[model samples]
Target: MAGFIALLPLLASANAAAAEPGPLPAGWVAAWSAAAQAVPPAQDAPSFNRAPDTAGRTVRQVIYPTLSGASARIRLSNVFGNAPVTLRSLTLGLAGRESEVVPGTLKPLTFGGKTEVTIPAGSAVWSDAVAVPVQAGRPLALSFVAPTNAIATTWHKLASQVSYVSGPGDFSSDTQGAAFRGHITSYVWLDGLAVDAPGASAVVAIGDSITDGMRSTLNANRRWPDRFAALVSSSPAGARTAVVNVGISGNRLLNDSPCYGKALKTRFSADALDQPGVRDVIMLIGVNDINFGWMPPHSGLDCDVPHVRVQAADLIAGYQQMITSAHQRHLRIFGATVTPASLPADREAIRTEVNTWIRTSHAFDGVIDFDAALRDPGTPTRLLPRYDSGDHVHPSDAGYQRMAEAAFEVWSAPRAR
Candidate 1:
């Protein structure tokens, strides 16, 4: 009895320390993330134009394949906004079907102990850590209300998942889906979600539409990165690694596209290197550059701004720059061979040169032969008939699965160095 009484003080102190937020445990790492891009209302789908302004309204965005964790934080971006954007409230919870959130799971999110936060233009902010239990491959809903008017917003154009917006007022805390009437395919404001997963790191997949899963089933989480995430989560090293998709549709390595974000070299720092706990990057870009290089001037497929025509050598130089940048950051970079795309013979020649360089040059720490994985053996320049999503550009679901498998095999293999 006397010993028990003496130990009470020590036990209470330990409990208090555990409850207080401090430096994250060494084991904690980023579980999931998405790159953000500025989208004009006019460029958005017709459904997205319904609610151009977020003033006094709540937007609920559902994210699939949230890696499991004991606690998590959300990242909000104003990277493309011309003016600061103020968020009045933020909430997170396990998602129910569609826009609804599971009851008894809703939790408030704050930034530096405050519910309201203003993210400056061309900047981003991470919310303070909160206790929110999450599971691997599950869906999580992040809801936020903007009291101040917001016009052009930073969003992920190819969410491949459906999200919702409330009519008016602050409905961020509501667990029911009734208040959400407007629907949008893009994820607004929300950029990335990081969870405190012990003994875990992350890999970022940076690329164009192929990596973006343009042809995959909507809301199905069938993107190659998503598939890779599932594979890593269930592997022997599952507890130590996570995968984040940073692919941007229509993105290029040498030229900027109005619909997509900046070129790979311009945004590599933010999209790949800056991601929380990112240790490796898998880059599979350049198809767009090859295709556009072959297009006639003012063919609508070319970049809006005229620039030096791109060639295989120019793209190889771009890859070299990316490799150097990643090396400077002490990150292991893997080069993924550009996939098969619908292009003329001239452009196909360029792609062949790029792929050969990627595979033999040894410029990258490793190589992922996505081209070999998806290309048809009979016609090496075209995607396999079963793998082609009918466009001859993007791969079908089965093709994505194969690509994921190839990536997983490389990731699992013992590194040469």
Candidate 2:
């Protein structure tokens, strides 16, 4: 009864292809299903092509990236739109490279097309599971002759975690077969994927914009989450846990609906919590609250204010609630201490209090001190000067690397996950 919300599995069918999911450990339970978060439309500035209800953006010749080694039975997102949307006149092909031609493959994707998908204005709908082999480091282009009438291009990258191309890469135009010639960054949905991923173990990164890896090199896809995933998947440290980022820019643990999160991509509960094989969650958000935007110090004071800031009790409660939610699924929830904030003294104080609370709280299964890793040795609460990403709020590429290293050192340890 206590704040319970039952999530129905993404609409799937018997014919949908599924991967042979590896077994869980002794104490593990499959609470959430593995599915990519986005049902993206067109990709531009990470925008969702939107129209009004009863309309959809029919991507002409689109290619979407798939989660590696995944099955074909997957869902799609129409999450960001002003109304219900539909994807039709479809053809599916294999991806060649960064951006190029779509390669014709033996495989193809389909749906109950006659029954158009009605993505509620505010929510997305998953397609009936289809069989598609998601290649590691490869993308699947979904081609169609139609267009969504009311197109609110979605944040395809947010969920799919793959890049799209205007044309196929490393392949010839003929390989694409039809109508696909140009190759720019792509934003389309691919099938043969699922949520509650088929993970041996999963890593859930929880945090703010930094963790969101905003402003990182575009199309380079070098966010620490991707790096961490690569690191965890290879060589000495390779553990079977899947890595999923649940960081919402400017998000606060206590503020479920913070203002910074209002404008950008966020699927916190569904992307991080509801993901399958997610045994661990690493939170790394907060900063804009402290920096307080251009108008430094509200009310003419020397400091800014976070109207939605979740101070002490609120933070504690938020952490406890998140952990409790994870526990119900028998998931192990790890608390990551807030990283250093590059704000003035008062803001730093608030961050320090929050970090301290995170460290001392018994509510988490474990605690990760990212603060210690990214802080300047000289100034414990400020992002290392060299790592600062211009704004003094975010991290540079090196800073992100430091952030990644710090987080990995803690969460990637044998003892933690």
Best TM-score among the predictions, by candidate number = 1
**How well does candidate 2 match the true structure in TM-score terms?**
0.70
Q: For residues 1-417, what per-residue lDDT tens digits would candidate 1 score against the true structure?
A: 999999999976754443232334465566667777767445434554333556678888888643678888888888888887788778989999898899999999987677777777877777778888888788899998865556546888888888888898899998889999987787777778888876568889999888889989999988999988889878886556778888988788987765677888899988888777788999999988776644556633333343446889999999999999999999999999998885778888899999999999989999999999999998888899899989998999999999999998888787722
lDDT of 1 at 113: 71
The residue-by-residue lDDT of candidate 2 on 66-131, one tens digit each, is 234434433445444466555544444465543333444624344543323444454544443334
Name the lDDT of candidate 1: 0.81
Once superposed on the true structure, which residue ranges of model 1 sit more than 4 Å away at CA?
A: 1-28, 41-53, 295-308
Candidate 2 Cα RMSD after full superposition onto the native fold (Å) = 8.9
TM-score, per-candidate, Cα-based: 0.89, 0.70
Tell me the deviation in Å of residue 185 in model 2.
7.2
Question: 77 in model 1: Cα distance from truth in Å?
Answer: 0.2
